[model samples]
Each structure stands twice: as structure tokens, then as C-alpha cells.
Target: MHLYYEVSGNGKPVVLLHSGGADLRDWTYVVPFLANHYQVVAFDGRGAGNSPSPTEPANYVADLLALLDHLEIGQAAIVGHSMGGRIATDFALEHPDRVSELVVVGPALSGFNFSQEFQEWMQRINAAFPDIDKVIERSFDAPSYRIIKSSPHWELMIDMFRHHLKKTTEWGTFESVWPEPPAIDRLGDMQVRTMLLIGDEELPDNIRTAECFRDIPDFQSITIPGADHMVTLTHPNELCRHMIRFLGG
Candidate 1:
């Protein structure tokens, strides 16, 4: 299935990919800012938003490459968050020439061991509720609920998660989808210019993920103090500013 994507502004191509639960809208605030300097293209991944879900993760990566081929973009800078970050790494690793620069936000690891604690945590989420509303509520709240409790996006976040929950049956959703965390070995050889962005308030593992790519020649990292996993939504301006500076806008 063709993924739904939007293009904004005009200039060098810059691609934006959203996290797992959310769609391209996650980049709403930042896309316009980046569009000022680059042609920003944001798309929803398979199983999220308008994109069709596939049981395989590699298929999703192929879908992204096909999208670029369709767009006739020889190369473009990529900015991905969470699951999108993982996808970005995979894409660059497989197609080194198509990527201009890579920026990963709160990037999830690849092929790394799933800690027993994290596995138990997943089990807890799996056991939460069969009801989509209850499960979405719990999944969304598991991260930034306390800090964004007063933010306007709290309702939007809940709504989005609930909508995603309904689209995929609760029984099959969690069971079918669990990303293989990134292996530190593969990241060491990532040839692209890479930037890892994380929030101080995000999970400890997320904070440490940036350090895993020390083998990449141009790897760099930055952290936002009060922001959490959903920092892109909370600190859109700051994120856009950093990206602009890094991409030499």
C-alpha cells in the first residue's frame, strides 16, 4: 500500500518520519519550520495512519525506499522519531547513497537485548485491557502523562492512540508488533552523518541510546532537559531550531 505523505515548501528534499503510535502529524509543528530551508516530506508508516500495515518490518523499509523512488528524489536528509528513527537507521544502513544526513529523535535501539524489566513491562501492557480505549489510554499515559497533563495535546494524544487501537484489534496489535531493538554493533558502522536527539526526562535507555553510535564518524547528540519521549510535540520549536542549525538551513 502506498503510504500517505505530504510535501511542504521548496528546496533540497528533507524527509520526516513519525513514531510508531502516531502518524505524519507528529511532525506538524516542526515540518513548516524545516520547510523554510528544505522541501519537507512527512509520511505515515505502514500500520499507522493511511499506510497499510504489514506483518514484516523490512517491508516497511522497502515501502519507504519505494516512496523516494516514486518521488524521484535521488537523496534527502532524514529525520525520524522513535520507530521512525529505527527505520531511518535501517534505510541508511541499506541504502547509504540515498541519505544526505540523518537525525534521530529519541531513537529506539535495534537488535539489542530486550531487558527482562522491559519485557516484563511489555507483558504488563499486554495484560492491561482488551478494550481499545482502556489500552490506548494506558499506552499513551505510560510515557509523558504527568508532564503533559495540562498541555492541550493531552486530549489529542489520547484520541490518536485510541484511534490507532481501534484500527488494529487489541488482540493482534501488541502481539504482532514489537520492534527488535538496535544492535550496538550495526550502529558502529552507520556511514551517514548522524545526530541523535533525546530528552533528559525520557527513559534511561533512551538517554543511553545515543552513545551506542560512537563508531559512526559524524555522530553527534543533544538532549532537552525537561522534555520526555514525546519531546517533538512538547518542544517543537527547540527541535526545529536545532535541526535547522545542524542541516545548515
Candidate 2:
């Protein structure tokens, strides 16, 4: 696969799909714990981290399949955060047999209409594009990041956001292709065991998204106290503990 990826530990494969505005570094805290129990495959999605900029409209789902095929991973537990969670949900719906389990952390769901407030917030950031500093400032000002902004990992988060914003300037197109009819419309079709993990202090849009996933059969949801959107960074131990228990480690 053209995407850059790293594999660690050894056991049933588990793939990590990071949130937008960051890279595989989003898993920096969570990986060490999960790696000790299962083989962890974390990669930079197109146009993020070490991955090449998209020359055409990006197809994240196809890129994921290519990664699995390249690693010869027949099936894996798919774990995703934010935008990554949206991708994971679509992937499981499109290729159910390839996903042994599905876990979405503060996921964004396709076909779920985002609140105007959230859309406007994103627009403000986009308007500051090219001026990386302003964009970064606006991005972190969201209620979703209230906790992380004061956490020790704030610098790391800023670094990733800065890096991703810089890289976006090199992209040919910002469009990303997902499975048809949207994952939100296909939740009932998901066959893999699923889990939804979120922080108590999340944006309304994300909380609404989580509600959509609740209707899925055999689904479980957990809320991490004292965490916001960046639960992976602030509560890695707790996140890993819940994940391991759910995955039956």
C-alpha cells in the first residue's frame, strides 16, 4: 500500500485509524497498551502524516482495504477516532467479513446532519486556511477540545494539527470518497461486534452520532469521565482497559 503504516506486538490484528487534523501520532498514548495485547497496525491516512497527498479524489475505504491486503491481515478489529470512526463504520458496512470487531471513539457519522454551529465553526477554520497559525488557533478553540487544550499533551496536539494543516496545502483536492448511501444509513447492516467510546464532554453532533450507533445489534457504549474529544490522549489507560475487556484480552 502507498500509505505509511507501522505494525507492533503480536496476536489477532487490530487496525488503528486516527482522527482528522492529526496522524498516527493520535495513537501515541493508546498504542503501547494495546500493542502489549494484540498486533497493532496504525497508519497515516492519505494526505496526513507520512502518507502522500491525494492526486485524485481520495477513497479512504479503498486505501484501508489496500493496507489490509498489503499486510495480509484477513480480518481485524477496526478501531477509529473522530473522522477515522466514520471511515471504520463505512468499511465495516461495506466489507463486513473483513472486520472482526468495530470500535468508534467520538466518531463522526456519515449521513448524520451536523449542527449549524459545528458547520460554522469548521467554516471559520477553513476561512483562515493558508494562515496556519490562525487556522490552528480557531481549530483548538472548539468546545470539543476544552480539556485537551489544558492537558500536558496540548503541545503534541498542536504539533499534529500544525503539521496536518501544512500538509493540506500540498493536496490536489480535499474531497474524500466514502461508501455509497452513507454509513449512517447502513448501521443496521453492520455485522461485526461494535463498540462506541466517547468522552462525557463531547460536542452535541458527536453525541447525536453515538445515538445512531446505539441502535446497532450487539453494540456497547462507554463514556469516559473527565475527557472530551481527545479521550485517546487524556485517558489512554482507561480507553485501553475498556477496549481490552471488550475484546476479551
Q: Candidate 2: where are CA atoms >4 Å away?
A: none
Superposing all C-alpha atoms, what RMSD in Å does each candidate have to the true structure?
Answer: 2.8, 0.8
Residue pairs with clashing backbones, model 1: 109-181, 109-182, 110-181, 110-182, 110-183, 111-181, 111-182, 112-181
Residue 229's lDDT in candidate 2: 99
| Range of the 10 consecutive residues with the lowest summed lDDT in candidate 1 | 170-179
lDDT score of residue 164 within candidate 1:
66
In the range 75-155, model 2's lDDT, one tens digit per residue, is: 999999999999999999999999999999999888999889999998998899778889888988878899999999999
True-structure lDDT of candidate 1: 0.76
lDDT of 2: 0.93
After the best TM-score superposition of candidate 1, give how far the Cα of residue 143 lies from its true spot, in angstroms: 5.3
Best by lDDT: 2
Residue 46, model 1: lDDT of 72
Relative to the true structure, candidate 1 reaches a TM of 0.89
Q: Cα lDDT of all candidates, in order?
A: 0.76, 0.93
